[model samples]
Target: MPISSDHRQYWQTNLRYLAILLTVWFLVSFGCGILFVDALNHYRIGGAKLGFWFAQQGSIYVFVLLIFIYVYLMNRLDTKHGVNE
Candidate 1:
């Protein structure tokens, strides 16, 4: 079956947003948590070492946050495309 133009546009927009969000996800997780962990550990937030927390827990938290953000954006896109269900 042929897909409608609206479906194609929705998918394209979704893919673009996914790519950008994933890139930022990777940078925050690996770049900040692992690569710069030592430097980050010098800083403290709420009495815990920032980098340590980021390496151990913060990245995962950020990932979950990103998921919610992606979903929210996707929902908005769906409305724009008249594809919400």
Candidate 2:
């Protein structure tokens, strides 16, 4: 099935957002959690290990947050572009 121009634009916008968000996600999760973890471990947060928390739990929470952010932004974009469904 062929998509209309409106749908194509909508999909393009969504893809752009997805790409940018995923890139940031990977940077935070892999870069901060694993690559820079040793440096981060030197700092402690509220008696908890910062690096360890980020590696084990923080990344997942951030990813979930990103999901919500994406949904909200997409909804706004859809409305702005008259693509709401």
Candidate 3:
């Protein structure tokens, strides 16, 4: 059977959110940690290197934050599609 338009749209929305969040995570983890590490290293925070901090600790915090953001966003999406639990 063919998928309903609403169902298709819902999946699309989910994918869109996933793509956005993943992009942000990637930018934060890889971009900041590696690409801009040298630039960031010019500045110091609490005597620690900014880029190293991002590579080791900041990315982890951002990941955990993204998890909650994903949960919240998916809940809203579910409600919008009348599929909320």
Q: Which of the numbered candidates is closest to the native, going by highest lDDT?
A: 3
Off by over 4 Å in 2: 1-5
TM-score of every candidate: 0.84, 0.82, 0.95
Model 3 misplacement above 4 A: none
lDDT of 2 by residue, 1-85 (tens): 9889888888898999999999989978998799989998999877767887888888898899999999999999889878689
**Cα lDDT of model 1 overall?**
0.90
1-85: candidate 3 lDDT, tens digit per residue: 9999999999999999999999999999999899999998988777889998898888999999999999999999999999999
**On residues 1-85, what C-alpha lDDT tens digit does candidate 1 reach at each position?**
9999888988999999999999988988998888998999899977889887887788898999999999999999989988789
Per-residue lDDT of 51 in model 3? 92
Q: How many residue pairs clash in each candidate?
A: 0, 0, 0
Residue pairs clashing in model 3 are none
Model 2 gets an lDDT of 0.88
